[model samples]
Structure formats: C-alpha cells, structure tokens
Target: MRHFRISFLVTFILMAVSGWWGYSHGGMPGLINALWITGVLGVMEVSLSFDNAVVNASVLRHWNEFWQKLFLTVGILVAVFGMRLLFPLVIVSVATGLGLVDVWTMATTTPDVYAKHLTDNHAQVAAFGGAFLLLVFLNFLFDDEKELHWLGWAEEKVNALGTESLAVLITMGAVAACVAMGPVEEKYSVLASGIVGIAVYIGVNWISGLLEEGEPDLQDDEEEGAAPAKNGNGDLVKTVARGSIGGFLYLEVLDASFSFDGVIGAFAITNDVVIIMLGLAIGAMFVRSMTVFLVHKGTLDEFVYLEHGAHYAIGILALIMLASVKYHIPEWFTGLSGVAFILVSLWSSLRYRKRHAAQA
Candidate 1:
C-alpha cells in the first residue's frame, strides 16, 4: 500500500484532469464517459503489463538504489511522456510529413482520420516491435549460462544451441518470412523497420557491455585504496549507470514494444488521444509501482520461476505481434494469454517448491 501511494495519487490527479478535459470538450456526459473510459483503459494497460512488471523487478533488484530511483522517476517520465505521447505523434508526423502541431490538431479534431493514419502504419510498427521482442526472447532462451530448466530437456537444448549469431539468424529469418508474405507495397517498410529494430538492439547491447566493463565490481570498489568513479553529479551515479545501463535500455525497449500494441489498441475503445494518454499513463505508473513492490518485498526470489514465465509470455507476445501483421488479433487475446502464462508459471513455481521441500 505504501509503495503504491505515489501511483494512486498520480492516478487520481490524472483521472481528474482527464475528466476536466473531457468536460471542456463535450459536457457533463463527456465528463462521465471520460472518467469511465480512462478507468477502463488504465486497468487494461495494467492487465497487459503485469508480466512487464515482473521482468522489470527481475532486472531492478540487481540495480543500486540510485539507479532504482532513476527508474522510478526518469524512467516513468520517459514511459509516460516519451512512449505514450511523442512516439505516436512521431509516427504520424513521419507517415504524413505533417508537423507535430498538425498531427495533434488532426488527432484531436479528426480522430478517425488520425487513427487511420496511425493504423495504416501498423505493419511497420508491428514488424519493428516484433523483431526486437523476438530477439529479446531468443537471447533469454539461448542463455547457456542459465542452469534452471523450466521444461527440462527442451530448454537445456535450446540454451546449448543458443549463440548470438544463431539468435540473429533466427530473427532475420522471421523478419524475412514476414516481408515475403506481406503486401508488396508494405514489404520494404516492414523489412527495413525490422532490420532497424535488430540494429538498435545490437547497438544498445554493445553500448551496455562497454559501460558495464568500464565499472569495477562491488568487491573492487570496496578496496581501501581505490578511488571511486565520479560523474557530473560527483558520485557513483556513473558507476551505477554504467553497471545497469544494459538493463535500463532493455526495460525501455521492452516498454516501447508493449506500447506499440497498447497505443494502437486504445483507438478501439476511444479516439481521443488525450484520453488514451492519460489512461495508459496511469496504468504505466501503477506497473512501475508494482515493480518496486515486487523488488522491495522480494517477490521474485520467492517465486523462483516468475521471471522465466514473464520471459516466456514475452516470447508469445512477440510471436503474436509478428503474426498480427497479416492477421488481426484482438487486444483481449494478447492480454489473456500473457496472464495465463504468468499464472501457470506461478503455479508451477509453487509446486516445484513443495516437491523440493518434500525431497529435502
């Protein structure tokens, strides 16, 4: 409860603002509808992002407090404003060659057309997000160092064959297949976007490795004669940043991939970009709060395989989004499937613990 206090306050304040904005645009009816819609959207985002919270906690628990604060503060801001607001607008701007102001006006005044404009590029967006997510999943699966095998033989084999080149080859093959099957007009865009996604992942990973390598380990830092690293803030913020840089970007990209589906799906419920932004932002805030809660309460350690489940769910999502380029999968399907994976993994974790205890 204490962990969620900030999220609750932010949600209330944003909901009120959304209501006021609705009233200003329409009237009493609009106000009521706005509140209802916002609540629904917020809940929807949270449901779709529950696994995201677990994965985030898995990464966050390894970070220092300073980095965690940075995630809660700067990360949330980026999640809310960066992905929620600017990303869609940027897409619209790029597609239509319209200025930001024009895009905003179109989205607000001519919502149907704005949605069309956005949805029209769904293939490229799906391809990019899907490719990135697929790579993430593959990388996790290919982790030969991972000793825990949820599926026993299958996972062990996959991990054994897992290498960077193999993951890239598989991802490229998936993207190529999509491009080959896609419409002639959209094929180039889809292919290019997917390649860009792959490139971005590689670039970020490389940079993270470099940053991490530059920092000394915790044991080395504790040496009496060692001088601590300094940054613009005159502290070990740099060290923490370097150490967790990979995780920071990974989480951000993961959020963006999730946002690709969410931002587009919001149109099904409402055309008002403002309403969608407010609602999704609230949900994102709560998810972040949940991540913190999971970390502070040691939920991940207790659950054991929760992180595995989340990653597996993420893999399904990546495949679904890739499949969605041609077929239209409902948002409900994505959300429910993720929840199912998480719940099953949780049940498995509990059962495993019981069995192990009995054996002991």
Candidate 2:
C-alpha cells in the first residue's frame, strides 16, 4: 500500500484531468466516455508493461539509494512526458517535415491525421525497437555464467554457445529475414533501422562497461552480517557497484523500447493525444512504483524465475514487433503473452520452493 501510494495519487489526478478535458469537449456523456477510455488505456499500458517492471527490478536492485530515487522521480518524468507525449510529436515532425508546434497542433486539432502519419512510419519504429529488444533477450539467454536455468535443456545448450558475437549474429539474421520478407519499399528502412538498433545496444553497453571499469568489485567484499548479492535467478552471486550513468542510460533506452509499441497501439483505442498521454502517464507511474516495490520487498529474490520469464516475454515481444512490421498482430495478444509467462514462472517458483523445503 505504501509503495503504491504515489501511483494511486497520480491515477486520480490524471483521471480527473481526463474527465475535465472530456467534459469541455462533450459535456457529461463525453466525460463518461473519456474516463472509460482513460481507464482502459491505463490498464492496457500496465498489462503491456508488467514484464518491463520485472526486468527493471532485476537491474534496479543493484543500484544505490540515490539512483533509485532518481529513477522514480526523474525517470518517471522521462517515461511519461518524454516518451508518451513529445516522442510521438517528434516522430510526426520528422516524418512529415513539420515543426514541433505544427505537429502539436496537428495532434490536438486533427488527431486522426496525426495518428495516420505516425502509423505510416510504424515499420521503422518496429524494426528499431524489435531489434534492440531482441539483443536484450539474446544477451540474457546466452549468459554462460548464469547458474540457474528455468528451462534447463534449451538454456544449457544456448548458454554453452554463449558469445556476444553469437547474439549479434542472431539479431542480424532476424533483421535480415524481416527485410527480405517485408514489403519491397520498406526493406531499406527496416534494414537500416535494425542496424541502428544493434549499434545503439552495443554502444550503450560499451560505454557502460567503460564507466564500470574502475568501480570497486563488491563480490569479494562479503563480510560477516553483510547481505549476499543475488542474481536474477535468485542465486547468490558476486556483485559490483556499477557506474550510475550507464545504468541510467540503459534503463531509459529500455523504457523507450518497451514503449514504442504501446504508443503506436494507443491510436487504435483513441486518437486523442491528451488522453493517450494522460493514460499512459498513469501506467508509467505505476510501473515505476512497481519496480520500487519489487526492489524493497526483494520480490525478485523470492520469485526466482520471474526475471527469466520477463526475458522470455521480451523475446516473444521482440519477435511479435518484428512480425507486426509486415502483419497486423493485435495488441491484446502481445500483452497477454507476457502476462502468461510471468504467471507460469511464478507458479514454477512456488513449486521449487516447496520441493526444496520438503528436502530440507
């Protein structure tokens, strides 16, 4: 309850704003409709992003207090305003050769046209986001040093072949396949965007690695009464105090990737830019709060396979995004797939705990 206090507050404020906006446009009926849509959109965003929160917790658990607070405060601002509002406007501006103000006017005054312009460029967006997310999934899958395996047979084989190069190769192959099979006109854009995504992932990681080079390794500092560090699999492991900038940048980019699809999908529900932003903003707030809750509660440590499930969901989502570049995959399917993985992994974790307890 305490962890979610802020989220609930934000929800109320946003809903009120949404209701007022609706009333101004269409009186009582409009207000009712606006509130309904806003609530639905908020739920949609939350459903689509639950895995994002879990993955965020996995990385955020390692950060110190200052960075965590920054994530909740500054990071939420970026996720809400940056991604939800400005990002769509920016895309429209670039795609249509309009100024920011012009794009904003178009979005507010003639939302359908704004949505069309944005949707028309969906292929490039999908390619870049899908490629980046694919790399994220592959990196997690190919971690050779990973101790626990959720699906041992498959994971062990892949982990044995773990190499950064292999992950890149697979990602490149996926992009190439999409390019070759996609619309002839879209091939170039998809290919170029895919490469850019790969480069962005590599560049961000390289910079993060460089920044972390001199940090004190916390792995060897295990002392009496000191809490042991835990991996995503909930296994005790060596840890390090990482440079905050790299982690911060990594998380921001990750949030952007996760949001690309949601922003685009929001059009299907409503073309009202104000509603879209407010609804998604509410969802983003909850995600940040959920991440904080997970970190404070040590939920990841307890759930064990939750991270694995999230990464697996990410992989599925990446594939779906890439596939959607050429096909019209429904957004509901994407959201439900992730939730399914989390639930199954959660059940598995409970069973594992029970078995271990019996053995003890």
Candidate 3:
C-alpha cells in the first residue's frame, strides 16, 4: 500500500480529469461512459504488463536509490507521455509525412484516419519490437551462469548450449525467416528494422558494461565492510555507478517495446486519442508503482521463478507480435497469455519454497 500510494493518487486525479473531459464533450452520460472506458483501458494495460513489472523489478533491484527515484519520477513521464501519447504520433508523422501539428489535428479531429495510418505501419512496428523482445528473452533463457532451473530438465538442456553470441544468432535467424516469408514489399523494411532493434540492444549493453567498468569490483566492496548482495544466480551484485545510464536506456527501450502492443490495440476500443492517453497513462503509472513495490519488498529474492516466468512470457509475446504481422491476434489472447505465464511461474516458486523449507 505504501508503494502504491502515489499510484492511487494519480489514478483518482486522472479519473476526475477524464470525467470532466467527458462531460465537456457530451454531458452526464458522457462522464459515466468516460469513467467506464477509462477503467477498462487501465485494467487492460495493467493485465498486459504484469510481466513487464516483474522484468522491470529484476533490473531495478540492482539499482541504487537515486537511480530508482529517477526511474519513478522521470521514467514514468517517459512511459506515459513519451511512449503512450507522443510515440504513436511520431510514428504516424513519419509514416504519413505529416507535420506534428497536422498529425495532432488528425488524431484529435479525425481519429479513424489517424488510427488507420498508425495501424497501416504495424508490420514495421511489430518487427522492430518483436526482434528486441526476442533478444531479451533469449539472453535470459540461454544464460549458463544462471544456476536456478525453473523448468527443470528443459531449462538445463537450453542452458547447456548457452553462449554469449547464441541469442544474437537465433534472433538474426528469426528475423531472416520472417523477412523471407513476409510480403515481398515489406521484406526490406522488416529486415532493416529488425537489425536496428538488435543493434540497439547490443549498443545499450556494451555502453552499460563500459560504465560498470569504473565501479569497484564486487568482491573488493564485500571485503571493505559493504554487505554483499547476491542475485538469483548467487553472483555478487555489482555496484551501479553514477546513475546507471545503460540500465536507464535499457528500461526505456523495453518499456517502448511493451507499449507497442497496448498503444496499437487501444485503437480497437476507441479512436479518441485523449481518452486513450488518459486511460493508458493511468495503467502505465500503476505498472511503475508495481515495479517499485516488487523492488522494495525483495519479492524476487523470495520467488525465484518469477523472473523465469516473466522472460518466458516475453518470449511468447515476441512470437505473438511477429505472428501478428500477418494475422490478427486478439488483444484478450495477448493479455491472457502473459497472465497465465506469470501465474504458473508463481505457483512453481511457491512449491519450490515449500520443498526447500521441508528439507531444511
């Protein structure tokens, strides 16, 4: 509840604004309808993003207080306004060659046209986002250093083949296959976008690694009387130096990838960009709050398999996004798939805990 206090406050404020916006547009009936739709959209975003919160927590727990505070403050603004509101507009502007003002007009005055333009470019969007998320999942899946096996024999088998470059090779292969099977017109665009996605992932990690080089070695810090913190793999946590620029960039890009599905799917429920932003913003805030809660509570340390479940869900989401390039995947199915993975993983964690306790 303490972690969620600000989230609840923001929700109330947004809902009130939503009501006013609705009333001004259409009166009492509009107010009621606006509240209802906003609630639904908020729930949809939260449901679709539970795995996102878990994954975010996994990264955030390693960060210092200053960076964590920055994440909650500045990062939330980026997630809500930058990703949810402005990102779609930017995409539409680039795709349609419309100026920002004209695009804004189109979004507000002629929402259907705006949505069509945005959805028209879905193939490229899906390709880019899918490629990045695929790499994220693959990197986690093939990490031989990760000792905990969530899926038992299956995980062990995958871990056996783990190597630093394996994830990249697999992702590149996936992109190539998609390009070959895709429409001839979109082949070049898909390939280019997928490559860019991979490049961004590698670049961010490389830069972050460079930044981390300046920090004191984990073993040295432990000997100096700093309490040692071990991660899920039992490796000593490295000190985050001077604001962790790499981790910040990685988190932002990851949020953008997750936002792709929600932003595009919102058009199905309503074409009004204002209502969509308001609703999605509420949901995005809650996701950030959930991330903070998980970090502060040390929930990940307790539930070892939660991170495994989140990465697995991310993998499924990456596949779904790629598949959606050619087929219509229901939004309900997308949200439900993620929830199912999280629930199963949580159950596995609970069982592992009980078994370990009994053995002790």
Candidate 4:
C-alpha cells in the first residue's frame, strides 16, 4: 500500500486527463466512450500481464535499488512509449516502405488505412514476437539446472536430457513448420523474421551472461554483508557494474517480447492512436507499480510456485501466437488463459504450504 501511493494518485490524474482529452476530441458521448475504452483496456492489460508482473518481480528481487529504480523509470517508459507507441509505427513503416513521418501522418489523418496496413502484416509480427517468446518458454522448460518441478516425472525426464540446445531444436522445428504453412511469397520473410527473433534472444542472453560472469557470487556478498571491493576477474568495476546492467537489459527485452501482442491487439478496441496510447500507458504504469508491491511484500518468497505459473502462461501464449498464423484467437481468450494459470498455481503453492505446516 505504501509503495503504491504515488502510482494510485498518478493513475487517477491520468484517467481524468484521458477522459477530458477524449471529450475534447470526440464530444460528450465520445468522452464517455473514450473513458470506458481506456478503463477497459487498462484492466485488460493488467489481466493479461499479471503473469508479467510476477515474472518481473522475480527478476527485480535480485537487483539493488539503482537497478530497481531504473526498471521503474526507464523500463516503464520503454514499455509505454517505446513499445506501445513507436514500435507500432516502426512495424508499419518498415512493412509499407513509408517514411516514419508519413506513417505517423497516416495514423492520425487516415486511421483506417493505417490500421489496414498494420493488420496486413500481422503474420510477420506474430512470427517474430512468437519466435522470441517461444524461446523464452522453451529455455525455461529445458533448463537442466532448475530444481523445482511442477510436473515431477515429466519435467525431470525433460531436464534429464541435459542437452543444452534441445529447446532451440524444438523451437527451430516449430518455426520451420509455421513458415512452411505460410504463403509461398511470405516464406523467406517469415523465416528471416523468426531467425532474427531467435538471434536477438540469443544475443541479449549472451551479452547479459558475459557481463554477469565477471561479477562475484552474490551469496558470498550476503555472507559478508558487502559488495566485493574487487570483482572475481580482478576488474576495476564496482559490484553493481555487471549484474545490474545485464539483468536490466534482459528484463527489458523480455518485457518487450511480452508486450508485442498487447500492443498489436490494442487496435481492435479503437483506431484513435492517442486513446490507445493513454489506455495502454495506464496499464503499463499499474504493472510497474504492481511489480514494486510484489518485491517489497516478498510475494514471490511466499508464493513459491507463482513464477512457474507465469512461465507456463508464457508457454501457452507462445503456442497461441504460433497457432494464430493458422487460426484466429481472441485476445480475451489469451488474457483469460493467463489468469487461469496464475490462479491454479497460487492454489498449488498454498496447498504445499499447508501440507508442510501439518508435517511440521
């Protein structure tokens, strides 16, 4: 509650301003409609992204204050403006060979045409976003080092394979199938986009791993109650220099991958770009604030399996996005499915705690 005071107040002000702006643009009825749409979209984003918040908190709990603050500030800006606003235009501009300025003008002056162009290339966007997210899900599933298992025997067997690249193999096969099923003209572009997605995920992880490798073991610092005066490799860098930056970048890229669908789906609600921006902005802010709440409240420590649930949801979402290239699925279904997974995982965690207490 204390952590979210500022966010709640800001949320109120933003909603009011959003409503008034809606009224100014669309008159009294439009005012009412705009406010309704914004609120709904905000709720939709929160529902769809509660798993995102949990995953974010899992990453954030490891960071020091500076990195956490950077996530709230810089990361939120990227989620809102960078992915929400600018990313859409970038996708349209690249697809249509239009200048950025021209795309912006089209979005404002001729929204329907802009939307057609946007939706026209949904397959490529889905392929890219889906490929990146599939890798995220697969990597977690195939992690030989992950000790906790929700599906004990199956997970154990999968983990036992111990091969570092099996996840990538499966993901590559999935991408190839999707590409093959796509139109002949789109095969090359689709395959290339997916490869780019895989490459970006690999590149980001490699860079982050390289940076983190130089940092001393965190458990050592916890035992000593001090950051190392010197890092493991005898580098001059401060302890914060390595892990924090790498972790921040990793989380931001993860968030960007998570957000790709939400941003694309926002157009279904309304064609007015400003309304969509404000609506999504409101949701993005709430997610940031919710993450802080989770970290400060130690929710992850209490609800141990919550992170597992979130990842499972990510896996499901990845499959859905891949399947969407062949079949249309509603955004509501995606949001609802994610919420259902989180709820079931929460129940499982509570049951585990109760049984452990009885044994004690």
Q: Please, what are the lDDT tens digits per residue for candidate 1 over residues 210-279?
A: 7777765656667766675555664565656554777798899889999869989899999999999999
Q: Candidate 1 regions off by >4 Å?
A: 227-234
* Candidate numbers, best TM-score first, in rank order: 1, 3, 2, 4
Q: Tens digit of lDDT per residue, candidate 4, span 1-360? A: 877776677678768987898888879998899889888878878888898898889888987776777788888889888988888899899988999999999998899898888887777877777787788877877887787777778888877884647777777888898788777887888788778878877887787777777666767777989754555545435445543666677677677766767876888888887778788888888888999889989998898788889988988888888777667899999999999999999998898789888999
Off by over 4 Å in 4: 216-240
Which prediction has more favorable lDDT, 2 or 3? 3
Comparing 3 and 4 on lDDT, the stronger one: 3
lDDT of each: 0.90, 0.88, 0.89, 0.81
Candidate 4: deviation at residue 181, Å? Answer: 2.1
Which whole-number lDDT from 0 to 100 does residue 31 have in model 1?
96
Number of clashes recorded per candidate: 0, 0, 0, 0
Candidate 2, residues 1-360, lDDT tens digits: the string is 899999999999999999999999999999999999999888999999999999899989988776788899999999999988888789889989999999999999999999999998888888898999999999999987788789978888888888999999999999998788789988999899999999999998887787677554555555445575455533211122353577777788889988878998889999999999999999899999999899999998898899999999999999998888889999999999999999999998898889888999
Looking at model 4, the pairs that clash are none
- The total of clashing pairs for model 2 equals 0
- TM-score winner between 2 and 4, please give it: 2
| Clash pairs (backbone) in predicted model 1 | none
Q: How would you encode candidate 3's per-residue C-alpha lDDT over 31-72 as one tens digit per residue?
A: 998898888899999999999999999999988887888899
